[model samples]
Target chain A: TNVDASSSNCIFHWKNSSDWIKLNVGGQLFYTSRTTLTNSDPDSMLARMFSTSSNLHPGCIDSNGAFLIDRDPRYFSPLLNYLRSGSLILDPDINPKGVLEEAYFFNIQSCIPLLEPLTIPRDEAPLS
Target chain B: TNVDASSSNCIFHWKNSSDWIKLNVGGQLFYTSRTTLTNSDPDSMLARMFSTSSNLHPGCIDSNGAFLIDRDPRYFSPLLNYLRSGSLILDPDINPKGVLEEAYFFNIQSCIPLLEPLTIPRDEAPLS
Candidate 1:
């Protein structure tokens, strides 16, 4: 579909054609597409929040109207990235435990396997 | 981030955690993540329609409350796939022209470069 600026019926042709959503995760602000959230998991909390047929409304919103999620934002990027792509690319500096927690909160089951390998079992930890 | 089912403050812990969104495009049904649509392009129409901050409401809806879009559904899958991944994986049987037209209608500028190579200019057609 070539860009049709003159297509009267086309939504993209409208003057205000931006659907970018802002998320206030914890105290940080992040921008993303609704598709990314819904595609993460059909059973995930994020998916249901955006579902039009669902009776549940967003629990909170910031002054800017971004969805308010009271969770640590530090680990959200990887989760979002995982949703965009089917794989998780870990950040070496980030603690896998934290990300795993966030993934679980979001009910991103696919992310669990990817994070499992990075988690060191307590019994396996060397004396420290 | 761990899936804490008992966490009272966590939204994902709610019994109804699914946030999946349904979209009706050109009479066909498509399921996707909000992130995919917004991530495709901040300036695109799909992004704006899903943006909570935007004043424009969705134009149409099916009985199920799926946002209705008037356009050819045939080319939507590829566009959606491209949004999920940053690349367009074309189907051999699908016409690039139709996909290009749809891409233009959605204002998916990033898809244009990926599709341009597939479109054979009229001048390049061999005598037939």
Candidate 2:
């Protein structure tokens, strides 16, 4: 489930390849980043975005130097948005910070945080 | 994400309610019990099956215990299957018990365990 608080748009569904079926809000579906999209190889960039087969979860900042986010899918860093030259700002209703915190409490780490400067309140800034 | 080792089939996808999109065998979709099911509704049975709205999650074994499985949708007891009653039997390819065990280890209690005696091997019987 890719939730863009920035756009207040949430995508909850399955993946076959690069194709995505948009989820209608207020529906019951579980999103888990599962991907081995039949049409796209595991090496493909789109595959990287949502594939659990790799064991290299998207935002994983490993001790090893093999990171793909900013380069391929630009994971963790929200590196995708940064390169595109825009912010992945969130909305007040979604509360990206708070939502992720709650999800973390449930131990769902794969729920990637999409924090963009546009959405952070004027009173807040990313902590170093 | 509905996984039936019964068919050695795993369909992980987003639901608009009645229609289910299929997921790849080894992919990431993050299946949660999420559903208000826009195409469906609060009163619809299909909506009841997969929705997260209305504060009702599927298969909730509760303290007060006003449960929903076995009647309208058949819940905690694999109510959905008993109705069809063909036996939503599982297959050896997917070890339902062990998978739920590991998920439980990580505090992921939502991964539903599909236990049909056929797949449970002759020695195992669900503890009452």
Candidate 3:
């Protein structure tokens, strides 16, 4: 669990006690496995945060010991779903624009195109 | 957080440090607030678990310190959403029947009616 202060590349092993991870997004809580976070997009912020090469141990932690990510929970929920199911299905009340912003912040490149079309208003001035 | 062994009523003050709580449902992790768990259905198991009158302190704990609930995480996701938004929207790939069973298990009476209709097959052999 020790980190070399002088090295730019952090090397640490993922905890083997459990594959499941607890997350606190903004003020909301979410639980998912390490696989779900990294498998979706290896380059995403979430993936990098939980990956073995990254130093996630020093991240902000909630009272419950869950890693804290400062992002809107409402938007983060749908992104978690997308990571789990590989589909961009948002609840009717959820704003696609909000989810889109979160997707970009998380570096989830795959969800951008799926969300971009939904963000556009159908009533927009038809490309005159 | 003391529970009178002789009296069934358990008296406990919810931790004041954070309204947010961590949950581990059948190995899956989730983070949510105490309000979201109880506000939707005051009489449900989740509400009772987080309620001041219930004995939730000694419940199972995960390695990361999340309260463990032994339930199917798949179906639990939609129920969590229902609690959040009071809407019964399910992903296209999710089974309505599964969610219905989970709703019943959690004693979410309000969601049962919404899910029942969705569970019935419209193509069923005309009521012989």
Please, what is the whole-model Cα lDDT of each candidate in the order they appear? 0.66, 0.29, 0.72
Q: Rank order by TM-score, top first?
A: 3, 1, 2
Range of the 10 consecutive residues with the lowest summed lDDT in candidate 1 chain B: B10-19
lDDT tens readout by residue for model 2, A32-84 = 22322212334433344345554333322111221111110111123222222
Error of 2 at A46 (Å): 11
The residue-by-residue lDDT of candidate 3 on A14-101, one tens digit each, is 3233545778888776766676787878889898888767664528888887888888987887678678656565544568899999
Interface RMSD of each: 16.0, 19.7, 11.9
Instruction: Output the lDDT of residue A88, model 1.
Output: 69
Pairs that collide, model 3: A29-B31, A30-B31, A31-B29, A31-B30
- Which of 1 and 2 is ahead in TM-score? 1
> Which 10 successive residues of model 2 chain A have the least lDDT summed?
A66-75
Residue B72 CA displacement from its true place in model 2, Å? 18
Against the true structure, what is model 1's DockQ?
Answer: 0.02
Instruction: DockQ for every model, please.
Output: 0.02, 0.02, 0.05
lDDT pick, better of 1 and 3: 3
Compare candidates 1 and 2 on lDDT and give the better one. 1
**Cα-based lDDT at residue B95, candidate 1:** 63
